[model samples]
Structure formats: structure tokens, C-alpha cells
Target: MVIVSVVGGISLLLLVFLWSIKRGQKTVRAFVFLSAVADGNSVESANELAKRIDLFAASELQKKAMIMVEMVFGGSQLKLISHARREGFDQ
Candidate 1:
């Protein structure tokens, strides 16, 4: 009986640890997605990955952060494009 209880406890602990890792990865994915959005890159993969991972961020905060990141990304993209165009490397 004691041996069985020990095994069950270890199993439960392992499950909890796995869950935490999944949750943490979700948060990291969201942050990465936000960055991609900010730059306005076609981040289909990152977006899908972030969506696949489950996170606990409030919808409002997530949306705002995404928008903010998107704006930053868009700004940088424009600057680079302008610079490239001026340098005669338009593509």
C-alpha cells in the first residue's frame, strides 16, 4: 500500500510539472506573437503556435499588447523599406 501511494504521488507531481511547462510556454509564445505582430510580419506560424498554446492573459491586455507590438513592427518595416528604396535595392 505504501509503495502504491508513493507511486501515485510521484505521478501527480510529474503531471503538475508538465502542466506548468505547457502554461509557461504559452506565455512565451504569446509574447513572441505580439512581437511579430508589431513588426507586421506575416507570422502565420507564430500566430498559430501562440494560439495553439493555452495562456491566461486577459483578452484586453493581450489585444493591446499585440496592437502595440504590431505598430512597432510596422514602423520598423517602413523605415527599412524606405532605406532600401533610397539605396536602390527595391524588391
Candidate 2:
């Protein structure tokens, strides 16, 4: 009985850990999407991007979320900008 309970507890913890990882991956993907929005010329101003970020981010995490989005964008700025330019030219 005790062994069974221990196994069950460990299984529950593993499941919770897996769920948390999945949630984190989703958040990262959202940050990447926001990064693309930030880099795109379609947004007229930083304020507009901020508003969109505010909508996507939780109130408490707005600043951190913005930083992450910026990091994703800034880190890939060359590639992203080139891709954007290429798309624009193609269009």
C-alpha cells in the first residue's frame, strides 16, 4: 500500500511538471509571435505595440513579457528584418 501511494505521488508530480513545461512552451511561442508584431512595420508606434503586448500579457508580467518579446526580436533582428524586406519586395 505504501509503495503504491509513493508511485502514485511521483506520477502526479511528473504529470504536473509536464503540464508546466507545456504551459511554458506556449508562453514562449506567444512571446515569439509578439516579437514578430513588434518588428513588423504595420505597427505605427511603440505605444501600439505596447497596447498589444498589454493585451497579450498578464498584468503582473507585462514588463517581463515585453522584455522577452524584445529579446526574441532583437536577437533575430537581422534575419527577421531581411525576411520582412524580402516579403515586402516580393509583394
Assess each prediction's global lDDT (C-alpha) against the native: 0.51, 0.48
- For 4-58, candidate 1 gives per-residue lDDT tens digits of 9999999999999988655444434555555555566555654654555444543
Query: Candidate 1: deviation at residue 1, Å?
Result: 1.2
Top lDDT prediction, candidate number: 1
Candidate 2: stretches off by over 4 Å: 41-91
The number of residue pairs in model 1 that clash at the backbone is: 5
State TM-scores per candidate: 0.47, 0.46
Looking at candidate 2, the ten consecutive residues that score lowest on lDDT are 82-91
Instruction: Write the residue-wise lDDT of candidate 2 on 1-91 in tens digits.
Output: 9999999999999999978654443344344444545576443342243334332353455455446546656644344434433433211
- What candidate 1 gets wrong by more than 4 Å, as runs, is 43-91
Query: Residue 30 of candidate 2: its Cα lDDT?
Result: 48
lDDT of 1 at 90: 17
Query: RMSD, each candidate, Å?
Result: 14.1, 12.1
